[model samples]
Target: MSEQAPHPATGLSALLASTPFARAYTHTALAAVFAAFAVERIAGSVALATILGGLAVLGVGILVARRAEYSLVRLAPTTLLMFLAWTLTTVAWTGDRGRTLAGWVALAGIALIAVVVALVRDTLQIVRALGDVLRWLLSISLGIEILSGVLLDIPIPFLGIQGRIAELGPIQGIFGTRNMLGFATVIALITFLIEYRTLSVRTGVALFSVILGGVTAVLTDSPTVFVVAVAVALVTAALVVVRNAPPERRRVLQWVLGAIVVVAGVTGYALRSTLIGVIGAGTDLSLRTDLWSTLVPLVRFRPVYGWGWFGPWAPAEFPFNYVNAVLRESHASALNAYLDVLVQAGWVGLLLFLAFAGVALLRSWLDASQRRSVVYAWTPLILVALLVDSLFESFTLSGFGWFLLVLCAVRAGQSRSWRERMRSLDGPPGGVETLPAAGGVQGPDISRG
Candidate 1:
């Protein structure tokens, strides 16, 4: 008997070829790794890592296109707009020219992959893929936290920095900073809540991740993150209740509850320093106040374009020497994400970004009203939390944020189109499926039809 020859495409190769959803999951998972741990200081810069990653994605996209039967046009407008915004922002505002150009190229390339995913796959497939990716990310992060905790006595170089032995009592995780860790925890927490309605096992994992994230945030001793995360979570929970309540009472209840949440959040912010003191994190609050005071005048200096992408008034040209200056402080502010955008992109960029976001939010609400899909509820709420986080943290420009935004927009657009198509087929009475096919790919037996 002849020996059996090895299959040409085995293991990862076969997986990529056979499963589009898995391919998407792998791409996003790799992207997350780059986003979370790719340190520019150690190896080139963040921009360089993004460029290399983008190149790899572009290569895969090309290969996938050659083999798959799909239409890229489904995501054309979104892809075009995303590329345009990144390019214009880089050309017009970004101070570090090389980094800006590279960043824009990387973003455009990522947008291309988003388009491919959106066009080639259905909505549920995309969501499932993303869910899987997030699950894996949380699991890995959890394991790291556990290892770091157990090896506290070992003095491992990088792992030791993840958490102090004391901070690991109930929960602990490694993140760039206390605030970022908290912010990430909030994301996982919210995601877990959403998942709880469907996947109980995944929900348990997400809950564990959330607790770890929260503990890490507290350990960082950043009162701002802890307070902000709680506030945002409360608001999100309220929104979910309002959105999901009985239709008869939803309108009035939503308005009343929403107004209350707004008033409460505002009042709390006004007394944030006192609140921080109450929680034994007064110094962190005071420092943030000082930073805000410094940033206010700085915002007025170049109100239109503000300092331009990642600016304390164009660092490359000015050479920010005041290491002690409040402007040089890292992620310190009480103002929300919208204000953050205003300071960086100026009013013009802010308005454009808001407009894009507004459209997506409106579409999501409309879909929920029609009771079309659950994603309508989940995506918007996540977007809102992310937007709120942006004000206090510089997260909008992050790869994860951009990816989520584009993904939500694609889902919204597709859902809208699907609803319209269904309406057209239903005619006036609204109960029909046998719509005549147009002069296009009418399936394999078009001649018979």
Candidate 2:
């Protein structure tokens, strides 16, 4: 008797899992990795190593498996790689060499995983994976709040739930801070909205997801939520207007928007004293300002080379401990992404980071404005969230925040990177994009309808 072949669907799935720029396998892995990022506090620092190690191994395996598909010349965006390279270089001069190396590993490892996912998965797929992970996380967050507040009536010290859900929290959720929960829910809200707008999820599911995100975000009770909501709302409105504009008028509209943003920023700065008074600046506001002020003097000592690349401040590290001691506070991060980079990697690193974010934002924003597809909007909106949130928190420097930043950068870079232009003119394979009919996140089935 002839040997029986595996069932066609099973064979197809298995084949896809191991194929070039593998999707199903990568999607599953990405979801797990993202989930790990969300609930990292559950297991402590080892969780990062464990999850990232798993991702790193999977990343290398995929690259090896898909060797024929990759082109060294047309690899990741120059800006991204340059930034990573600069971060790695910081280990040479860091105060704590061991910690720096460890930090660089997490940074580079997350970047690698993001690069892989950005290559293999489309925008919707990434959104889908993130949405699923966030839904589980948010649901769990709500459950834990219920258990800790209404049901059990005891604070969960390990998870940092303060049993304040009964008081309509400031809930930390699976994230370790209220601000973090607010940020994640904002991202979830955006993802859920995109899923709805794109018809990627069923109507009921999308609606439920939106409600869930809203409820969770509200319960977080973070002041950042207000700022984030406004920023996202404004950006969403601008994108809608830009996308709907005539192709010829779109450029003019963008310039007008830029001018308006400049004017608004200047006005805000001029009135900052009044605004500060209105907002009661003595709270979180003063802490950030004081933290940044302390970081400024430290950054000056090694302005060019920096203190080295510790993503999150190590309490035991010299300058970190020094800064914390000066403030008499146990701050985990510098509370600002730019300030964090300035203190850790110095001026050159800051320049590289600015270029990295600026280029990505410009590319993605242009893509969103020009493309008729709604998927094009995700990258820019996400970048806006990350960049804006960076002002208040260093979330974008690590964890899922960094992952999203890199992932969006990769997505944007693919549309209009130098490598893409080179590949077009040269007419050869363009690094992991050799697969047929697999385009950059533009699932044609989804519509503006």
Top lDDT model? 2
The superposed Cα distance between candidate 2 and the true structure at residue 24, in angstroms, equals 4.8
Model 1 per-residue lDDT tens digits across residues 1-449: 99987676554454554445445544554345334433343344565466557644754744463343323334444534853474456456555666555545655555555544544444334444555555555455556555665655343344324435445432333444555555655655555554444343464665665565455555555555665576566755665676667889877886787589678879988987677678776665466567556656666766777544542133333222231353555343223456655655677767767766767766765554445334345666656656666655555455555556655666566556434444354332111112112211112211011
- List candidate 2 segments past 4 Å from native: 1-34, 37-41, 276-282, 425-449
lDDT of 2 at 234: 94
When summed lDDT is taken over every stretch of 10 residues in candidate 2, the lowest stretch is: 430-439
What lDDT score belongs to each candidate, Candidate 1 first? 0.52, 0.79
In candidate 2, which residue pairs get closer than 3 Å at backbone N, Cα or C atoms, i.e. clash? Answer: none
Candidate 1 ranges with C-alpha deviation above 4 Å: 1-18, 21-35, 38-52, 55-96, 106-131, 134-136, 145-162, 169-174, 200-225, 243-258, 278-281, 310-340, 366-375, 416-449
**Per-candidate TM-score against the hidden true structure:** 0.70, 0.90
- Candidate 2, residue 419: lDDT: 74
TM-score of 1: 0.70
